[model samples]
Target: MTENDKPAEAHEQDGTQLARENWERYQYCVSRGHRDYTRLASRLEGFYLGGGEQWSREDLEILHEQGRPAYEFNEVMPAINAAVGYQIHNRMDIAFRPRGGDATKELAEVRTKVAKQIADNCRLHWKETEVFGDGMIQQRGFFDVRMGYDDAVLGELSISVLDPLDVMPDPDAKSYDPKDWADVTVSKWLTLDEIEGQYGKDARLRAEGARALGDEDFGEGDDDGTSRNKFGWQDTGRYDAEYAGGGPRRLRVIDRQKRVLSQMQVAIFPGGDVRQLAGDEKPEVLEQLRANGAFITRRMMKRVRWIVSTCDALLHDTWSPYDRFTVVPFFPYFRRGKTRGMVDNAVGPQEALNKAVSQYVHIINTTANSGWAVEQDSLTNMTTEQLEEFGASTGLVVEYATGKRPPQKIQPNQVPAGVDRIIDRAAGTLKEVTVPDAMRGTQGPETSGIAIQSKQFAAQQGLAVPLDNLARTRAMVADWIDYAITKYYDSERVFRITKTDPLSGKEVEEELTINQWVPESGGYLNDMTSGEYDVVVTEQPMQVTFENGQFQQAMEMRGAGVRVPDSVVIRHSNLTDKHEIIQQMEAASATPPDPLAEAEAVLAQARARLAEAQAERARAEAVNKSIEGMFSSAQTATLVAQNPAIATAADGMWKSAGGIDKDAAPAIPSIDAPAVAPPEQNTNPLTPANPSVGMNAGIEGGQP
Candidate 1:
């Protein structure tokens, strides 16, 4: 046989054998992984919902056989609920960051906004939280990202959480990302009309025929516990006797997805232009490309493909447009090549707590009140029956033989002190194993806010791995969404998202479009298909607290004269009207200052300076006048000393005006000149302080 003919012969194999092989592999996978995990996960979910022992009929029977009541004192629910609540309380958002060229950065912003709008439209937060809660309770969670047209020309991106039991991944594969798995199978129960609507009438007819073949030929589904928990009792019988038309005829439709090797041709031209051909080109197309100076090269790659089949027939086969598996699996606590949940450790203690509390209640019920021990001869108006009925009544009168010792009271049986302690310890152990008191917001009355915050932070740190796992999964989902955007959104489309603007702190509707034609570049602007983005998950467990702290810090900086921007301060504030407030601030900034007011302020300052200068000048002139008078007196004294007649006349004038009194004041120096005078007799106030001073000293000192 020729090598190329082998695939044709393989494809010619009987449909029944192919179906058998696929179904058997699916069964094998279910046996090895899905079935056992489903059972455990279901029980864990029961425990989380306060019904842990509800389906354990054998255990309840055993307890009843032992004369104990069957009860479920659910201490597990609180811890699990608290853990789930913690995720809900601290909401997170997914962001896309550019990892390529400058164009990628611009596209990333538009994509980020588009992603947020998609998330809001699909209510992604609720789905994410649901998946997280399931993972915490059941050890695994899944998300499905896909494009849906919904009867429109343009496709929309959607994300949904899938039930863990409904998805069967490769049992031996150990990877956090689903794209790395060897294969995965997803099963759904759909009515014939539903299947026909999705896969066409021909496919639906074949699936219906397969359903009629019974377990011997088509094989029975191993979905006893799993499907019942999720889909609730799917009737897989050939025909429903209770219904007139077989009750819509539901069938198990399995989509087995895997990657297959494929080849693509890359054509390189002389002008450095390259194009990829998907190996389906005609001879003429290749010859034309060769004539255009193109070098053709082939490269082998793996591409995602999935098959739709029932137990007896292969319905369809197709390749996925997206780069990887659409379903993303998140294992919060993957260890030792296996995935386990936070609830795993707490399950044992939780059961013990339930049993302990149940047993304690039984003890109280059986031994709470005491019975009487009475003398037989002691009889009054009351018989033994009456005494049994009324003996415990208050103010009861019992007439007995006078000396018959009063009926003695029997001691009541007490529940053992250790039972209470056991229940408490089991409950505490359950909490410790799962969430702990700190995470549950338990604290002493005297606990300071700082101390409480510290404890809460420590508790959060303990669960950081799981939170990180969730974040990583979200990043993968974001990447998938980005891929869908590039692949499906080839035309300009508006994405209207309602969000709180980071700058304004207000809920506003934002619209953005991608792949719009740009005449300047002669190509599309914001070409989403041409760039790469890295997904960054922004967790906001304390968004309010963070924003409040930022706002306070900004205000303080402004108070300290730090020139902080009003826009920045407004952005961090929590006011609902911040958009309006910001708008006012921007408008005020854009408006010009009043020129007349500025001039008036400058003039006021100038006038104050002028008054100060005038006052300074007047003080200087008064001092100058006093100094001139002193200098004139000294000059006159110098002239008088040169002529004795003037000195004698001045002395007479001084004496006549009573300028000098010998008894009260020292005698003034005489104007009459002497060749030399005694120093003690020199009483003139204007005399040079230093005998050797220069004659021009006064003039020089008074020059300015």
Candidate 2:
């Protein structure tokens, strides 16, 4: 058939229409983003980099005409950098935890190691810092994660930070997360060779043809002024010499990911997830499933699909392997479906500060010295320039016209009373609206150490939103890496994991292999694909200053008898060779003891035993003495009480010795005396004696 006689296929037409629609959609998104975010983000980034023009164009032009310097002291940069450095120094670590049965615990550990390995291999920290800086300066940041291949044999997960300008999400979407947006488009300029290498020769040819077409709608080879203005491009002659000036054409490649819900015929495996089936394969798969008595069903499900296209051609179209888009976004201050950033808060005050400073300098420059007030053309001996230049020189003579009054010296006006105060106020406001002095590591006005620490802590707390957003982004990225591992590392693969050994204070490298099927267990050991996992992000401060503080605190605790181990204290130190030091300490401990020291130790033990024996003997002696004292007191009491009995036995001897001292003795009562009971007497000792008791009984009348 002739070249024009062949009919266009329906599939080609559909692809072309889809490509056009996608291009249109991308254009609309770009337009909206430029209006809503990109322009402002560009300005904010300028502020961060110290390039944001504080004065208006007209004002700047007037200042330039007047030979006045438009000064800009970048307060925004210091605040933003302080915040970014805070995150970098106090880095966050990603950890994986088993969310399924206990069987998944080991696998989750392996996943954690693998995740860390991925982050290390990809330099995720640096990228994270860039993303964080962008988010703080602008309103959002993005992380793109995907699997890359090494030597086309081994797969590795890669993470990179995406420039906010390169990413365009659905502006009308009611969420700030890119994954939750209805669609997200990432654009980049690629050379033809790069295009061929990535998308294939057909794509390169199509892109080349589109560039040759030079259609503005195709977004290729067309340098609309928007790119230059939005990105603040200078006259670099790149477009004149390279792009449309006969050099190689660079095409803008768009990767658009969209979420869609569709109805599909799916085969439901026994106790498994449903798998979608194509129209042509549905009947055969159904028959096979029916033969096996498997379940079948139809359902509507949401799926993410990626479409790669240029302006005029579709390069690739496939369903995303991940559950969500690969690009994750972090918006620090999202409210009402929009975003605000630290720079936004500081811009007003920063501009004011700059203006105040600039005006102060300008006033000083203009009024630092006295000027001469003279009539027009009053100088006679010298020109105005020469006269003014030599006026400040010593021993210079000034000659004015004889008719004109001699030039009068006009003193400059004093600077306004509150000019310094205005500058200080503006500067303070800038700091207050953004990072505080405490956050910048500056000493505050508080005299108490505790007050200073509390102020610093409060300042850090002020950044909780951004820091928490960063942690959330990290957790999300961890999940992405985990999913990627499960999808890509489904074969026996060996990788090394490095970790700090807590006991030895050294980094230990371990080589692990996963996904090896075992017939005995009927499953793969360390299988990442088998179970669900949860991601947790924890802060691990990497700054030496923080480590030093921790070390000092640990030492103080140890001094206070807190029982903190020496090895742990050393681990908190910032010494680069602390592990070596620990090793040396351990070696010293393990060495054989000195003979003399051993002998001394033995003698010390013997002395302790002897002291204990002596203590025991002393206690026994004390108990015996106590018993003897009690017996002696009892014996004395018995001897004293027996005096009455002894006196009764010696009655005859006493009578002979005293000659019966009967005259001095009182009359005794006889046995024949009246048996009358003695009258009741008062028992109280203090009462008067009852002298009538014995006389009334009449017992004293008869003596024995």
Instruction: Spell out the clash pairs found in candidate 2.
Output: none
Error of 2 at 56 (Å): 5.7
lDDT for each residue of candidate 1 in 1-704, tens digit (9 for 90 to 100)? 66456674465355557667677877788788688888888777777787544337688878878888767777667777777777776766767787643336667788877777777878888898889988988888898888877745677887888888788888878777776788888876666787788778877767767853332211234453443453334455344334546456566667778878887566677666555554555575565467657789976767677777777777766666555787888787986449888888877887787778888888776553356777888987889898877776778787888888777777767788988998889878877778878876779889876687678778887688888888788788777777676556666786666777666555887667677877988666676655456787787757666787799899999999999888888888898877889888877888988999899999999999999999999999999778776865675565555554556566666688876565643223555446444123233436744344433345522222
The local distance difference test score of model 2 is: 0.72
Error of 2 at 499 (Å): 1.4
Residues 481-506 of candidate 2 have per-residue lDDT tens digits of 87777656666888877778979987
Q: In candidate 1, where is summed lDDT lowest over 10 consecutive residues? A: 212-221
lDDT for position 196 in model 1: 82
TM-score of each: 0.76, 0.79
